[model samples]
Target: MAEPARRRPMRADARRNRDRIVAAAQEVFAADGARASLEEIARRAGVGSATLHRHFPTRRSLLDVVFHDRVEALCAKAGEHADRREPGDALVAWLGDLNVYAAASHGLVSSLLRDGPDADLLKRNDDCQAMITAAAGELLDRAQRAGAARPGVRVEDLLALVSALSLAAEQRDDDEGRANRLLDIAVNGVLLPR
Candidate 1:
């Protein structure tokens, strides 16, 4: 007789294993950088090294998966902010969140940007940058129209400023406070005379 088909998408045990692996990878990556070992990841996940290899055949695979996930999340947040608020507010909120995300992913981002193969992976999704830039541009236009921002600010310049602030914040022990302050300065500096 033919075997019965599985009712659900992922089996319960398989789901658990996948969740564990992702969680373990997050911790390992945070603590050990991109070079974190699969063996250590499996150990932390309470699975065998073979299982880890089965799930992620290479370190780049795992990093790519996580990085793409983060980028998607950031993009989604930007979309939501743009939809729900004034463009200037949306830009400010998104920029703050982006700073935090960048701080968290600094190591992986550096690795991806510096490594040739990984840089290709990062650049593969140009859509994310386009979305971000579009959102920033809309916000900047709104702020300028309202006379709340400088007339000639460009989204690219704002993005570079945000990135620099994020990197600087990452270096400080009080990163959260510093990031917030830097974001405040960025927003305030863009404002036109009351």
Candidate 2:
């Protein structure tokens, strides 16, 4: 396996500039999604456009950094939820959180799913899907083993369902609420008792 490339630590002022840019980018992205302007981000960060470009040469690069932490946190949340709740409860709660995240993030998730120009740059560096699958798989396994979930549920299919439901919800006026509602419907399908 190839060893990951090491990053040199940033200089103090450069570090500050980068941190400010990330903060600005997060706000702008929340309000504007992936098409949020780089120049506007620089302006908000109180940095020159050149500084923003210097720190993040491409929009994809900046986005990778901006969303990376959130993905990590989501994976971590799965573990925490697993520990605190029953297996089925933890899976449902984490899926709810994932639904909200996907609905809110908007364009960023679509960008990550793209297989065009940015694919080459993101393929190895961005492991959001893998990380999520690992976390989700553990939860699903526990639920299935405990007989609280169906044995055939696959992590990939569950994630895809969350993404699709969230995308549909994003078109609604009540984004998160709609996403949660849709997820609950999926989670609890109508059945006739045998």
Candidate 3:
């Protein structure tokens, strides 16, 4: 029987470069959407293309890492609210964070879903989506149990509502104002009657 391959810790400089590349990719992808340039990301990261490719050989791999990190950050934020805040405030605040995450994506998720058939890529995307939805559902359930949120609202409904509002905000002249207005309406609609 063949032995399993062993993994080694990354050297400090390589770890720094990897972190830099991921951060640069996030910023570039957010600003330029799905068609952002890898070379530009490398430049932004202060690394060579060789270094970037060494860490992420394919564009899809880089995208996956960037999105995975973002999703995990959102999950962490939601978890923090759930742990420390009042139930109603936790749901509302986490939903606000989710809205910001979706808005920052700028429709790149649609592009990602439609652009590839790579099984690994699709699976990663699905996993991230599940994580996000589960986080939101937990917050919602807490709020409902606390008599703050209305009963019977599904996580899918909440996510879809936020997605729509974020998309509309992107298309309008006053994006910040429009998104906040829409978010306020959605949040208010979900709350139990005073």
Candidate 4:
């Protein structure tokens, strides 16, 4: 096999520019979500559009890196729950965690789900979804095998539920506990006991 090409190290100023751009992207994404303007990010970072583009070739690419760490940590939290709780309990608890995270990250993930036209852009670019799916699948499989979850449950459906719950809660009143409360209702069901 031929040798792979070696990547050159970024210059000091370039590294600073990249960091500043990321910091600015975080702020802008927080403020405006997936629709945040790249030009605004560059302006906040004290860099030109060309410089920002040089660092991140596309908006999707920038978003991926900007939210990568949070996504990773969320997935990691799944692993933390798997062995600590009963399979069914673990699954429910993890969904609660995911609901909280999803509600908090409404800006970023709102664009990843099937919510609107802009969401399509993230469909192709998302490794974040894949990672979450894998993590959830592990806990889900355990639940099913242990008879904690019904066999018809699916990772995709679970994720979509969390996404939708987040959107609904966000649209409702400003009550911070609404998402978690909604999740409890969904998981426990709405029917009263006979």
Top-lDDT structure, candidate number: 3
**1 or 3, greater by lDDT:** 3
Q: RMSD to native for every prediction?
A: 4.7, 4.5, 2.1, 4.7
How far out, in Å, is residue 179 in model 4? 1.0
Cα lDDT of candidate 1 equals 0.76
36-98, model 4: which lDDT tens digit per residue? Answer: 899999999999999999999988788777777667888898988997998778888889889
lDDT of 3 by residue, 68-179 (tens): 9999999999999988999999998988898899888856765665555433564658889999999999999999999999998888999999989998998985547787
Q: What TM-score, to 2 decimals, does candidate 1 have?
A: 0.75
**Decreasing lDDT order of the candidates:** 3, 4, 2, 1
> Taking the candidates one at a time, how many backbone clashes does each contain?
0, 0, 0, 0
Candidate 1, residues 20-127: lDDT per residue as tens digits?
988888778866677777888889999998877777888888876666666778778877887898766776788888777767777666766665566676676677
Q: Give the Å error, residue 129, model 1.
A: 3.3
Per-candidate TM-scores read 0.75, 0.78, 0.92, 0.69
Q: After superposition, how far is residue 112 of candidate 3 from its true place, in Å?
A: 3.7
Residue 121 accuracy (lDDT) in model 3:
68
Candidates ranked by TM-score, best first? 3, 2, 1, 4
lDDT, candidate 2, 61-170, per-residue tens:
88888777678888999999999998888889999888877876766656545535554544654588788889889988988888778877788888998999988887
Instruction: Give residue 46's lDDT in candidate 3 (0 to 100).
Output: 100
By summed lDDT, the worst window of 10 consecutive residues in model 4 runs over 185-194
**Higher-scoring candidate on lDDT, 1 or 4:** 4
How far residue 116's Cα lies from its native spot in candidate 1, in Å, is 7.1
